[model samples]
Target: MGVEVLTVSSKGQIVLPVKMRRTIGITDGDKLAAFASDDGVIMLKVVKVPTVQDFKVRLDEAKDWAESVGYKEEDISDIIKSVRLAKRENSN
Candidate 1:
């Protein structure tokens, strides 16, 4: 909760304070996302990477929605091709 100092090892690893870890519910082996802000501040957040099954379920739902909207498989394929071509032209 208060200001705490930590030392980085030669391997560039720092142990978070026990109190801070406990308060934030951070456990050992948890994944953390680290990014630098525009102001040069580095921040870390606990994040989860979705599994393959998760993506499969999402794709199924999207397909169901598209079918409900009366879009056929060929229609979807053509739309995808058109969008890809447009994106390529814009990049050029």
Candidate 2:
């Protein structure tokens, strides 16, 4: 891991050093998840938001798997409710 000192601008923006950005594969227009702690520690993580096409692809895969496993459409609601009830009981 490498450390680089950064100064936050008045508008709450900070420029990541070129070396750090290159190492982490960060480019212009990339999204980052920022986390701040009560102790003043801050962390940044690269995040990718899925497009609608991506979500549809995943949904299709899930539907295919459900069909192959013999899970009918009518069974999903009962399965979800039972799972939620079990979780609530366990948490208590």
Candidate 3:
């Protein structure tokens, strides 16, 4: 683990140290997901936003796997309905 003390600017922006950025390959304009814990600790993670093509590729793979497992279209639809009903019941 590496630790570096950083000072927040007037606009509440803190420059990530060059060493840390180089280590993590964080370039300028990269999207970062920030989270704050109950203990006042902040964590930043590099966000890899998935494109529509990515979703389509994953869905195709899932469909192929399901077909190989002998699941038909109606079977998939029934599974989805069952899951949605279970979710509604749990939420209530």
- The lDDT leader among the candidates is 2
lDDT of candidate 1 over 1-92, digit per residue (tens): 54344688999898888888898788988876554334222334456665556545656786799899998777956876777787777679
Q: Can you give the lDDT of residue 51 in candidate 2?
A: 57
lDDT of 3 by residue, 1-92 (tens): 34555688999888888889888888988876553334233445446765556555656786799999999876856876777787777679
Number of colliding residue pairs in each model: 0, 0, 0
lDDT of 2 by residue, 16-79 (tens): 9988888888898887755333424334444666555655565678779999999988887787
**Between the candidate structures 1 and 2, which one is better when assessed by lDDT?**
2
- Candidates, ranked, lDDT: 2, 3, 1
Tally clashing residue pairs in candidate 3.
0
- The regions of model 2 sitting more than 4 angstroms off are 49-92
